[model samples]
Target: MWFSRGLGSLNGVITIDGLVKRRGKTEILSGVGFQALPGRVTGFLGPNGAGKSSTLRILLGLDRAQQGTALVNGVPFVSLADPVRTVGAVLDGSGAHRSRTGRAHLRWVARSAGLPLSRIDEVLELVGLADAGSKRVGRYSLGMGRRLALATALLGDPPVLVLDEPLNGLDPEGIRFIRTFLRERAESGRTVLLSSHLMGELAETVDDVVVIDRGRIVAQGTLAEVTGAHRSLEEAFFALVSR
Candidate 1:
């Protein structure tokens, strides 16, 4: 939300090595390893129960693994002196209370993150929510809620963005705006890890693809390499994970 200079050199590239996690008696992740390099948008792809959310949680330090480590810029995320300034994440919900106005929600986050109050107005405008700043999130459409979520993520202007299903509920214009925004962030040498089920979208947006199934990585490479003989990413995804 604080619109200073854009994040300059982002060292927050994600690295997960030999990550293993188990819930109850079931193994959720089996030595998963991947790298999301800076200056690129890395697409994390998998079917339901494929361990994507588990891995993301570990990376964000919201959950711990029974074995192995997940790092951001070579340091575990929890170890970052200023985690907010290092990485901004977007998930399913806007993370805003339903009764809170869009601006109220951002103000709360700003105060919690030690960001200046000025950022409330700046980020509201940045995500095209300036006109609706006073509107309660409950009354906002799905698309508007998503815009608010994104605005919150940008509040710290963090160099690394880890977004899951970011395209949810977006109109054509919203989708286009997000595409361009993410591309520009990556081009500016930031790290972006995007997890979405929209294969066609990822095919157009991501520089690299990582596919996991049944708690293990099945394939990972550039679009061309992973797709191989398939005509599209969706085809290749079905082929790789089905087995």
Candidate 2:
């Protein structure tokens, strides 16, 4: 995909084109193209092996694509001079040290970024972890861990947020909180790209969507444009991907 730096006045514009990835002889993605505009919660939807994780990894610069490009904020994520303030992500938080306190973990990240210590508590509270801020990560439930990961992502107050399965292990309340939070973030002129396999959730939470299947874009447009409310998102998704 090619972007001309003419993405209007959007604070962040993510462009991907011909994104190809191969693991050995098996092709993971082929010619995927899409654009995520700022100020909207763009849902990234796909089947179990539709290369969503691969795409997110490539976008975050954690993995390289064999072909094409993924640009964040009009530049490749890897080429960004300062990524912390440009983009924030929470792909997986299982890597965090289980024995460490949530506050300590956030403090470490802040220290690495040369950011002030107070920002840690602010983000922790922002993600609804204020009461459990001092608890060790191991003691926290999966929902709490997800909240902690969200806190980490919000630490930099980045303009773009890329989250994978953010509602993975959350309860109804947690999911509701995240839905509201993401909506508010977009209202604040930030960009949010959320990947999920849950079509029902996506239908309720997203303003726009990019649906992928077999590593290819099957549909891209506003929720109404992609899934006529008469046809549920799941119905539309299955019809598109199954083809």
Candidate 3:
């Protein structure tokens, strides 16, 4: 998190408005919209096939939408002059080639972005991969691979983070590490948009919640507001999506 430290000044608000997407004849996202304000951790919650991934893909500029926009600081992701310096994203899978060493993979990214080589060591240690950075990515365990992928994302020191299923494939300890890491980043004033199906986990970490179901947002507000009359976030999530 050191690389993204003190990024408050650069932090930007994340706005998703009326986004509509389609896959062949089926509609995947139907006028979805929300916000992850700067300096707060916002959880994007939805059941499977809830259009969470589709929304994230549009926001990260990984895919285009038929209508609406996902804006970072009031601009589209692809329109940014240097996206790496402004936003760091960690989507599904470790996103690292099995053939390259962890350190080598990071170095390549740093070089491509014109970032200094020293940032590599900093992020490696930040994600607790200093010792294994030299090992081949193929040999790393799932947890280690996820850490490396996170380290790669942090290398750019982006002020905004859009993470999709970051807790996937992690053991209990690994989950705790990432949970704490994300909270600390948000506490430090970085805008964080975390997408996951884990309601209990998000209840402990997010300041705000945005619940989506079947391509549309069912609710969006602070944890308590979103939870409504439910005993916990999980129960509230079930109620919202079950309808």
Candidate 4:
């Protein structure tokens, strides 16, 4: 697939250790830690208000942690010589300007990152946005916007992908596409770390699971291991957070 091209020998290994974050008086993360290994889709699952976002922010170096470390490929995100080629992150909705066309938005990002403009078309096609590439961002539906955001992330062709609530705005078909795409990514030796509260979708997509609740990690293991004796991952998740 075009997405797997140029991946080369790079490895995507995300390691979070003893991360602690506080917002004034409230503790956001308490000794949170986990690993997202290459060749696997690791679902960072947690309910709303859980420390998932905070942990991801710290991992991407967008936010500071009071203590501990989050490393990508054994080095801090900021320390990477070519971050764009190492990690692709989609934290929010397409960070695109409403006035610009989808293609234009990607052109701007590509130029800024010193990447080839040709890559824009490839990503747009990969995300099923080739026809909408000329449309203004304001004209896009929520799912289209999410796809655009994913396209932007793929522009870097990074070895690792970190996505937050990626399935939120997608329809069933879109969800299925993403699930298959991420699985293919992992199968092709990339690391995928996604944070989401959609239990059913996650149960189908992830190879490994990491569950966090109330600022602490409650479970981390393979899909079967984390799910344990529960009827499903959703049940196990509820049981863990309810404790």
User: How far out, in Å, is residue 195 in model 3?
Assistant: 0.5
lDDT of 1 at 112: 80
lDDT of 1 by residue, 1-243 (tens): 322334333265688999999999999999999999888999999987798888998998989999998988678989887777778888887778999899999988888889999988998898999999999999999999999989988998897899988887899999889988999999987889988767887688888999989899999998789989999999999988875
In Å, residue 20's CA in model 1 sits off its true spot by 1.4
lDDT string for model 4 (23-67, tens) is 999999999999999999999999999999899999989999999
Ten residues in sequence with the least summed lDDT for candidate 4? 1-10
Error of 3 at 212 (Å): 0.5
Model 3 compared with the native: what TM-score?
0.94
Summarize candidate 3's per-residue lDDT along 24-132 as a digit string, tens digits: 9999999999989877899999998899999999999999999998988778998887787788888887789999999999998999889999999999999888999
Better of 2 and 3 by TM-score: 3
Which predicted model would earn the best lDDT?
4
| Predicted candidate 4, C-alpha RMSD | 2.7
Q: Which stretches of candidate 3 lie over 4 Å from their true place?
A: 1-11
Query: What lDDT, from 0 to 1, does candidate 2 have?
Result: 0.86
Would you list the clashing residue pairs of candidate 4? none
Worst 10 residues of 2 by lDDT: 1-10
Alpha-carbon TM-score of each model against the true structure: 0.92, 0.93, 0.94, 0.94
| Backbone clash count, each prediction separately | 1, 1, 0, 0
How many clashing pairs in candidate 3? 0
